[model samples]
Target: MSSPVILEDLQEAFPGWCIWRSSAGRLWATRNGRRLSQYEIDHGLCQTIDADDVAQLAEQLREQEAAERAL
Candidate 1:
């Protein structure tokens, strides 16, 4: 089931950062005056999900964190 993402999830995941939706409908996360996209961190930097993807990426992040803790 596909569901629409919400802004609150982004806030919860990135309490230290801020999420922005550009006019072109692109999502970005900014922290410490730096901004980047979810894809950039996920693929380019091989980094974990932050706030760029918000709920979309947050679910994956939460699941991954849970699995790692179980190990």
Candidate 2:
């Protein structure tokens, strides 16, 4: 199960989006009725994170999206 705090951070970082974990434990974030990011958590990797990590992920996503838009 994913941490509620992390989910909350995602919500704050991307308002009006749906953030949830699938039954298989993959984390997903969607915005404007579209999928934004999907983090696979079943790889025995990071299953949880601190607030700073959440902030970093959000920033990274923003940068990626900006770069994509620039292309």
Candidate 3:
């Protein structure tokens, strides 16, 4: 149920990632850098983050950011 305005907001908020809504209507976020290391993957980093709504996707992005900053 995301609108274009919300999508634009998400893109602006997550400059380091590519965010979009799939044709199927699912929200997706992919990091705009190299692939995650095995360690990062083991720690919870993902290549693609997805959610059913904007709020859920934002929460996932926040969590992903925290994970990247973690030692």
Candidate 4:
């Protein structure tokens, strides 16, 4: 219902990631540590992940996690 509450829920849903919603309503997520490598980028991982909503954002994050594990 509030910004801080929503942020806390997002953090719980996606631990260790930095999550935020933009002024226009797009949801963004990025890892807390080092950036993705060149090989990871070439293989489709992103430096900053964004989506129209939470579900899509979760999907992208899951893919990113899987890709990183594969590397």
Candidate 4 at 54: error in angstroms? 0.6
lDDT of 2 by residue, 1-71 (tens): 23234757767665645556667655655444543333332322222322234445555445444544554
Q: Which candidate's TM-score is highest?
A: 3
Query: Model 3, range 1-71, lDDT digits (tens) per residue?
Result: 24334878888877889998999999999999788888899999999989999888888887898888994
For model 3 the TM-score comes to: 0.87
lDDT of 4: 0.78
lDDT of 2: 0.48
For lDDT, the strongest prediction is: 3
lDDT of 1 by residue, 1-71 (tens): 23336766655654644556767765655443545456545544323344445555556545544543554
Please report the TM-score between candidate 2 and the true structure. Answer: 0.42
Q: Candidate 4 vs. truth: CA RMSD?
A: 4.7
The list of candidate 3 runs beyond 4 A from truth reads 1-5
Q: For model 2, where is the 10-residue window of minimal lDDT?
A: 42-51
